[model samples]
Target: MFFDLALVFLCIAAVSQFLYFLLITSNHKDFVKRYNRDFKEFRPKVLLTVPCKGLDMGFFRNILSLMRLDYENYNIHFVVESESDPAYESLQRIIDRCRDDMPAGFAKVLVAGISKGYSQKNHNLLHSLRFAPHDTEIYAFADSDTRVSRLWLAHLMYPLRNSKYGVSTGYRYFIPARRRFSNLALSSMNAAAAQIMGKSKYTTQVWGGSMAIRKELFEQLNVANLWQKSISDDLTLSAAVRNAGYKIRLMPRCFTVTFEDMSWGQLFEFGRRQMLITRVAYLRMWLWGLFCLLNHFLGVWILPVAAAVRFAMGENDAKLFAAAAVIHWASLIYRTYMRRRTFEFVLGPYGGYVRQLSMWEFLLNPLWLALMLALILISSFGRTICWRGVRYRLNGAFDIERLNR
Candidate 1:
């Protein structure tokens, strides 16, 4: 009886994974169709905001790449919290070296005063918004650690030409750090998550690292009020745009690179924080989060155990486990084929490790999930999270405390 139940559960899990795979493929095709549409002739002035807190591994290369954008009319605004920040020094060095080489009106840096918000990035952005060119029609926000392709600005701006789209968010590709086990785990997890989320119709949250929107729409949305209490401003902004009857399109043709080399502890903390915010921002999609936990565990650990159990039971039933293994390999191959040469090389091998590591991580997942839920509950009870050397509290309505930080 127990064996029968296990078989049933295995079949259900396999079917759910298959369904998720179909959803992603369909969404990718839909995105491709929209991307092929012709862009309008309007060339709006752009303000690219880079909110810098500290130095990151690819900071210089990322900043330099932005200055080299293919767009004809755009300005890069580097925002820092204080003049004493080490990032300020790095920005100054890059400006001194690259400003002369960039296109006209393409480079500028500003020091911003702290504002009342749980998000330091948003606080820095609000101050820099004051310096935004009055004629600017598009506002682009990216993290300090993100690297962009040459055509990034062109693709980001293309969606804004349509009046229906209030904001456009792009995808993120991970740059693996050496051959470390934790790095591999982090990279593969991100890639798989992106594949699943990018392919969903109801998934509207924008990645904070690479997002673009119209300046007018942003003003209309009253972004300050919209994201005042939000820890994850990107998701909040996307939700706000959708609620305001404006479309938030996820473009397929463009993507940005985020440099993340998190230690095991840091990765856990970051993932926990993300899970907490996701619960609030995408309540409906929270089930998908649970699905992710289950999928990763089953694909990596549970299947192997089930297969072993079947093997001990009888050789004839071993086919059941073999079939499941084939499905797992096929899915990984498909993902590799789809991702192409981008990060698949790393993910292909790393995915195997993810499966092995899950045996251990799965044991702690229940506790971790409980902890994340508790954090969310506590956060809802009060609004504040200490982040990046600052403390911010939120009001009952999720608005930021107006007091100066």
Candidate 2:
């Protein structure tokens, strides 16, 4: 009876997840339609602030892409901690090569020192803002690791012309540079995050890597001051926007393309650190993620064992558990198929950034979920996170102690 009940639970959860996927698809489709309706002359004076520490495999290409944005009337501020950083020279060369093509004052790299007791990303952002043009009307932020399209800025800025939207944000999907199992597994798991984050109704959370805010709105909320007091910039900005009673609009086709190659251990450690930050920054979301992890753990690991135990005991209803196992597998496979479609549709002609998906890769997704569950389980007990060569101990969303700087 217990095995049968677990089977019922598994089937129900699978169906619900499928339904959620459908809803997100509908939302994304609407977004795409509106984005393509027509062009508007809503471009504002904008500053794109990108913070860099180390170079990625696509670092040169990524920076070049940013330097060649299709948008008009925008200046870029690339902030590095020191002239000693590897990216400094590369950025200088890009600016020199692209300067003649760019509008006057269009791109400049700033050498700013780090902010003590804060995340490196935020530290760089603070300095970038210091050099922002006095007349800039919009503040845009991007991560150094992502490659943005020519129209990425236009899409992000178009939605914020409305007075009600406090922020506009974009999410990223990862593509593995190699066919290694570790790389495929991690990339497979990351696709689900992009869909949920970009398509869902939740506007309170933003992705720092591809986000924009109106300059007046940012200053009204004192976002720069807020960043100083928080651990993660995205969560801090989200909370401040909510407190100010403003809305966040998720832009369509504004997803950044990320290329990565990592081993299983590196991927696992990355997942844990993310969860630990979530644990401090957004406790409720962290707990909900943990619950989902536990549920997946049961569907993938525990229920099968229970089914086997019942079958070995000569139970006639053991087949129900077997059916549940089949349903779980089908759900994962189908969900992954939908995610691939989402990527291709959004990324468009540039979709090649994400390699073609293979049917066999979905089989490893269950293992990915299991490993993520293990990471979550381990992170639930810890408050310390080693990030970008600095260690931090957390007590709450904004309460943090710098263990190392």
Candidate 3:
């Protein structure tokens, strides 16, 4: 009776949590249409600070796409470690192209020199901000890996005009043209993060890839100091925003598409690094995520175990176990469906990219779920992580020490 009762509870919990996850993912866009903040009326003088490293896919195209943005009053500041960096030449070409086609002061390329002891991106960004115009009203940050659409800037900046939102942010959708298992698994991992960070009401996580913050609130929170000491710039902004009692919003229609190629080892490394950072910055949420992932995977197989046990014992509750198994599979199927739907909603018109991602993503979605368990396991055991091939060991929430190889 105890086993039977436990099995029943497991099924119930599985279905309930499944529905809760679905509800959270569904809310990613439920409010996308209602926000009416317009960027044109404000016409804020925006400072776009793009701190770049190695130029990945769409290097020149992504940088040049900024020229096509619909917003009128904005300055593009592309910061790099140095002219020696591979990305610098592409950035200079972007600057040269802009100067010939647009006004003389439309774009500026700043070099932060090279740093081996501190975070290079932070150095590039903070130095660039020091030179920003005093009248700069907003700061826009982007990653070089993203392909931003023309309306990306407008959408990301629009909602910040509303006083309630302190930061406007958008995430990236990983789209792979090839259906390699590693690529599909990475795409799945990104989808799961997008739902949690962008959709869930419990927390409003911001992404640095595409985000905008008002200048007043930024200085008011001492963001520069925070960035100087932080491991993840986006999470630092999130912590600061939460401490200052402001919400970070997911901007509608502002999702950037990322096409970075990765192998299985690279994917695992990336996932582990991100989750370890979360474990450092947001311990409670990381614990909760670990528990949920465990429950989700283990709870999924409870019925099969019970059914096998019943069959072995010639138990009379065979039909009950079968029904529970059906509900369990149904719930998992629904969860997979909702994940695809989330891809479509957050990706907007660009969601077709997922369709081309992997047929296995549809038929063998469970493979990614298993890979997620592996991701959680890998993250659970890591103390140090590599960034741009440099190793760093955690000292605290915002501190790290360079690890000797």
Candidate 4:
């Protein structure tokens, strides 16, 4: 009787979760259409700060995509730790070739020197902000590794026109560099994360990779003061904005693409670092994420396990377990399909570039789920993480001790 009740409960949860996914996915599609139709033409003077550490995969291509942005009247400031950093020369070459076509003072690389208290990326961004032209209206930030669309800046900046929106952010969608198991698995895991973002204030956190804020509000909130001792830029900023009673706007059309090829070792390191950062910087979201992960694991596995146990006991209700498994799996698969369709619409032309990504994301969902659960579990204990060869011990959200460079 207990087993029967549990199976019924699992099936009900699976169906309810599917319905929830359907609602979010449908809302995302509608958001994409509405944003493109209504918010495509807001251009303001902007300062785009991109912090660089090392040569990431497709570094040159990613930098070139930024140079080719469709927006007008914006300056790109690429900041590195020092002139000796490998990415510095690469940025210079790209600037040399493209500066002629851009407006005068279009792109330049600045040296931030070594970080003293906080992350080097944070130091670099703070250094770059010091040079923001007084006329700059919007302060935009991008990561060095992701490739953005031509309209990325325009789309990212539009929502900030409203005073109620504190930050405008976009998430990354990884495209596998090779059709290998680990790369595809990482992409699928990341895709699952990217799908969860929408208009939900509870779920939306600012992603520093592709986020922007109004210059006036940025100074008013004193976000740089918050980042001065912080290891994380986005999470710190997210908390500040939320505390000020402002909403974060997640732009569906502004999702950036990253090309990646990770071995299993590299994948775990990356995933663990990300979750660990979230664990320390934003514990509430981390707890919420853990709940979702547990919910998903139980919703999918309870029936199969129940069915196997019943079959081993030679019980008749084993057939009932099998039927519940079919409904649960089918609902999950259809939800996955609808989510992918929503992403295709969000990505627009770039959708064609991600060949076989949907298939891999669907086929490898179970593996990624297990891997992600393991990552979150592992992150729950760690306070130290190494990012771009710099190791730091996170004492708390606002206290960071640099262990090494």
Candidate 5:
């Protein structure tokens, strides 16, 4: 009887996951088709904002890649909080190189004073906005750690050319620097995130790492109004744009590359920070968090039990397990195909599998839940976060209170 119940749960879980996979596949195809059609003749004045803190890691390489984009009539803005930031020197080097190779307008570094914002990224961006060309029609915000394809800006801006579309966000894939467990975890999380966003109706929110918007709409939408008490500027801005009766498009053809050499501790902290912000800013998203919990439980624990039960019940356990495994594997195979095609799957063999498995592990582990809860507590009650090397307190309205120490 116990085995039968387990089997029932497993079957349900497998079927649900299979349906989820199908949804994502369909959405991905639709997104691609729409994106290709839209980019045919779309061109707009673009300002690419790269918010930087330090020149740690491959910051220069990422910046240089952006400078080399094949788009026309666009300027890259490197927003640094302080003139003495280590990354400022690297930005200067990239600017000089770009000026030497290209013309004077290819890239520019804007040193700005940090403003009051819970997010340092937002603070830097707000400062950069002052220097943004008034004639610029599109705003593309790219993180300093991210690298983009030559066509990234073209693809992202193409959708916004339509009057109905207010914002367009591209996909992100992790470029694993090493074959460490932490890298595997980050990669897996990124894949699952793509799957989730791809399948969901709220594709409005762009990944903070890479997003673009209509400058006129962004100014009219008044994102800073929503930024108040919103820990995540991306989500808040996306939500505001959508609420303003404008469409937000997600272009699957364009993707940004993120470094995947983050330590396990860093990954956990990042995830916790994200969850805390999402929970506070988007209550609806928090409501859907339960589905994630169930999905993880089914993937790791329920499916295995169902296979055992079917075998005990004289059912074709091999066929059942094979079918379920095929469904799960299909999703992985598609992602692996994308990774390979994009050359984003640089990690060694089993990189894709390890990435998928880690998500299951995170879901099944009670420890992760406990840690998340603890972080939520801290994010809610605690005043400050130690970011990079600076500590800033969370003010009443998503503004950061700089600490002396």
Candidate 6:
């Protein structure tokens, strides 16, 4: 009786996940339609701030993509914690080489010095804001490792023209620099997170890698003061926006691409750091994610084990459990394929790369989920996280203790 009951619950969860996947698919289709609408005349004086630490994969190409944005009336402020950081020198070289070919605005590197209490990325961003021109209307943030399309700025800022939206966010999609197991595994895991993002309020969160907020809303919410000691800019800002009774619009066209090649250790560290941050700052979201992880874990791992045991016992309903396992795995792979299609619609230039990634995801999603479950379980017990070689203890969402600068 217990076995039968468990199987019933598993089937319900599987159907629910599939329905949720369908909902996100519909939301993505709406997002694609929004991408076709023109926003050429809605240019706002924007400040694009990217905080850098080390030299990421394809760092030069990523920075160059920022310099080549097709928008007008915007400036790129690349900030590093110190001049000693490798990215600082690279930023200088890129600006020097691409000055004549840049768009309407200028690109310059700023040194934010060392962080005292907050994460270095937040410190760099807040420091650069101090130097932003008084006339700047919108503040945009991107990560150093991401390569964006020329229309990234245009699409990210366009939604803010409506007063109801508090912030606009774009997520990152990973492309493996090499087709190795670890590289493909990390990309597949990252894609699983990215696939959940869409136009719905419940599903949208501020992604600092590609997000924009108007200056008026920024000051009204006192985001600068809010971010003073927070470890995560994107998650904290997401909370602030929602608390202030504002909506975050997910912009599909602004999805940034990241080319990555990670070893197994690096992959584990990256995954753990992200889960730890979410666990510390966003408990409810973390709990929901944990619930989803466990559901997927059980469906893929536990269900198969139960099926094998029943089969060995020569049970009559063994085929039912076996069929459920196949359905769950199929749902995961089908959803991944659907998500890749949505990405290819906007990031058209990387169509081949996204296609290749989908193949890896189909093959490795079960293993990826298992690794993700392990990362989530491990992260549940830690408050300290290391990001970009800096270790800090998270006291709460806003309180932080930096162990090293």
The order of the candidates by lDDT, greatest first, is: 6, 4, 2, 3, 1, 5
Candidate 4 lDDT over 1-405, as tens digits, reads 895677667666665665676577566667766776434567889999999988999999899888878777799899999999999998999898887786524788999999987899999999999999989999999999999988888889888988899999999988888888998888888877777686567777899999999988999999988899899999999999999999999997789988888998989888999999998889999998887787677657777887789899998888777776776677678767866777777777777645457777777687778888889999988788889999999998889999986
lDDT tens string, model 2, 272-349? Answer: 888888788877777877776676677677667767887998987677767766666566666666666667778776
Superposed on all Cα atoms, model 6 deviates from the true structure by an RMSD in Å of: 2.0
Candidate with top lDDT is 6
RMSD of each: 5.9, 2.8, 2.8, 2.3, 5.4, 2.0
Clashing residue pairs, candidate 1? none
Winner of 1 and 5 under lDDT: 1
lDDT of 1 by residue, 230-329 (tens): 6567878877888898887666545666666778666655555565556655665656666555564565456667778878878566667667766765
The sequence of per-residue lDDT tens digits that candidate 3 reaches over residues 1-405 is: 796787677666766776677676556546544442445566688888888878788787778767667787788888887788788888777787667664213787788885444466777888889999888999999888788877777888777879888999988888874667788778776776665555564656788888999999999999988777767788778888887888888875677888877897888888888888888777776787777776677555666787778888898776666776776677667656666665665565677776665355667665667677777777777578897766777666777666742
lDDT of candidate 5 at residue 332, scale 0 to 100: 46
Report the lDDT tens digits of candidate 5 across residue range 1-405: 796567656666756765665566556555454545335488788888888888646787778778877677788788887888888887887787668665225577788765554566777777677788878888888888887766677778777878897778876766567767666656655654564454356534667667888887888988755554445678788678778888777776566666657887787666666665665566576546645555544544455655566668678564676466556546545544443332223222324544554544444333443344444444545545566665656554354565642
For candidate 4, the per-residue lDDT at 313 reads: 90
Lowest summed lDDT across 10 adjacent residues in model 3 is found at 29-38
- For each candidate in turn, the TM-score is 0.78, 0.89, 0.90, 0.93, 0.78, 0.94
Error of 5 at 20 (Å): 2.7
- Give lDDT for model 1: 0.66
Clashes of 6: 0
Winner on lDDT between 1 and 4 is: 4
Model 4 deviation from native, Cα RMSD in Å: 2.3
Worst 10 residues of 1 by lDDT: 341-350
lDDT for model 2, please. Answer: 0.77
For residue 340, what is the lDDT in candidate 5? Answer: 36
Range of the 10 consecutive residues with the lowest summed lDDT in candidate 4? 32-41
lDDT, candidate 6, at 81: 84
